[model samples]
Target: MSPASPTATSAIADGVTDDALKGLRRWNLGLTVLHAAQAVAILVLGNGFAIAVTSTFPEGPPGADAPAPSSLFEVSISVAIAVFLFLAAADHLVTATVGRGLYESDLRGGINRFRWAEYSISATIMIVLIGFYFGITDITAVVAVIGANVAMILFGWLQERVNPPGRTSTTMLPFWFGTVAGLAPWVAIVINLAGSDGAPGFVIGIFASLGLFFSTFAVNQWLQYRQVGPWKSYAFGEKTYLVLSLVAKSALAWQIFGGSLAG
Candidate 1:
């Protein structure tokens, strides 16, 4: 990663201490193993998530036979979940293997360039899977959903760019802006679900659990920036993220495993 701008020192200088470094070191290894193990379990146990796009047409002329549905594309939910898991694991692994200097610099900047870079791809895929579960198949619509999520993550990166740790609280517009951008897909998903009859129990679980987890992630960022309570320590937010990543990825993977792969 490139050097963090000089604009990131207040939080690091005040929030990162000897105890915090020790804590970060422990979480760095723990989270790596946590994500890696979950990804491997999904790979070893689950076959794959099967998705076929089939359209049932409305009533047509009685004299003609309706056209048959065809599959547009097939994707493996296992792969999608695993991608998210591995990207998170890779983020932690970098600190262990590469050294924490870059990681610390990222904290100094109030953004982990590594995390956002991976989330841009991994979280986008996770949201795309959510799109599929919501019964969205139009190529254009799917692309739009992907764009929305990526834009949301880009806003996260922009949080650091526009207002680093050293920046005054008044310049924190990017953080709120990112939160708004993050809600775009959830709004779209809720809209879709509202029109449908219902969803499967496991599908609902996937949506609820992941949504809550993602929202919690944004909260972590918010607290860290606001210097609220424990979040006054940047390391506090880092640990929370580690736990959240583990829980979110594990919850999603296992839900899919139990739902579709048990057979």
Candidate 2:
């Protein structure tokens, strides 16, 4: 539903007035309703399937047949869209319900742990599911990729904290590191694709498409820090984020449905 970089750096003079903040908060609340509706529709209309898994741990003699892998937890891949969509809705719901003072303070500081936290889980899950279709089925590889995605998001959180507005315009180590971390999973996914004979064209399209969408979140933060034209307005960047979330999530949901989940 979202990507790296919680909010714009304070250095950008968006003149985020209280009225503007209130308006944006309402937008996020409205997003909650829309995302919730999509989640429900996905669950009601789509047939679900389990993502295969594997792991090794202390075990007794194998049964006459191959041992079933221990379940870290089971979730349906067919309805995966609903899962992340629900999570995104919950993130916005909390933002809307929370005290305005805290939300404004966090935004001003260039930190929104709520956004990163949800992205860490929601986006990671979506990517992992995508990787599965790429033939990245080894549990260790999957877990490692998941860790990389989560790390990328944590660095995005750090980007906000360490580089609060008015700080020296020196190097932004966290943002750069986060961007690299974001690349790791796609690299793994590509490797999976390479090993296979080939994959569906639409499947490859999913990879390229989502890769571009997620990349833009980092771009958004870069613009905020650079204080370039148009982006010089933090309000502009904020509005862009809402629009981005809507488009990116919808693109992903429909892409998955058309390419893999739909019969």
Candidate 3:
């Protein structure tokens, strides 16, 4: 049998490389959109919150016990933001399922399922936020929101463990750390919502939790760079992860924590 010519071999290699790069580009695009959507949703929500606060209590007496805004227009805006956020989360879930090849295999299927769960939790958080605009202070709603937040962190940890991005070892540090960071705000929210006179402590907890979350990503990125040399070697979604970590998480942390502190 004659061996393959150099031209044919090179052509086959090029085709395979092109296909792989195309797949990477697709994943990168999907993740970029998803991260951008989440960031936008957070910004919109923050804007609505700001509008409600200004319209309601423009003078003073800002705190957890501050009177709920009564302007129909402001409330409607907040509701709209919540709806948009929910839709974004839903869209990302669908895109992730397809782009990430969730159904391509059993392992992929599990990861995709976890991602869907996270997306659903995000949607539920938006719904609860909408209820806040409607002046729904039911303890159950607050608890549900906290529960969903915790669940999302758990799912994130599991996803990282099941499928470590690029080449990383599976460790429980992220899971434990995320649990502590994610739960801090929930605890604070629960305390405030439960009618406790602990607004200051609650505010502190929220701020610290946000700081912790942001710091975790920063540290992770540093570690990755230390180990992986540079951004070029990073995985397809790494850029999105870094951008979202800073943009989305910081926007959320600052908006809620800063607003509460100012109040």
**TM-score of structure candidate 1:** 0.85
The runs of at least 3 residues in candidate 1 whose Cα sits more than 4 Å from the true structure, single-residue gaps closed, are 1-13, 53-70
**What digit string (tens of lDDT, one per residue) describes model 1 on residues 38-157?**
888888888856776445353578767766655667787787788889888888889766857887766665666777787788788888777788887556567777887888888777
* Model 3 per-residue lDDT tens digits across residues 96-209: 456445322222211223334543455345434433433344454456555655564564545444433333233455455555645544454455556644445544444445
Deviation in angstroms for 225 in model 2? 0.9
The lDDT, on a scale of 0 to 1, for candidate 1 is 0.76
Residue runs of model 2 more than 4 Å from their true location after superposition:
1-13, 56-74
The C-alpha lDDT values of all candidates are 0.76, 0.76, 0.42
Pick by TM-score: which candidate is best? 1
**lDDT score, residue 164, model 1?**
57
Could you tell me which 10 consecutive residues in candidate 1 have the lowest summed lDDT? Answer: 1-10
Regions more than 4 Å wrong, model 3: 1-51, 54-89, 92-110, 113-170, 196-263
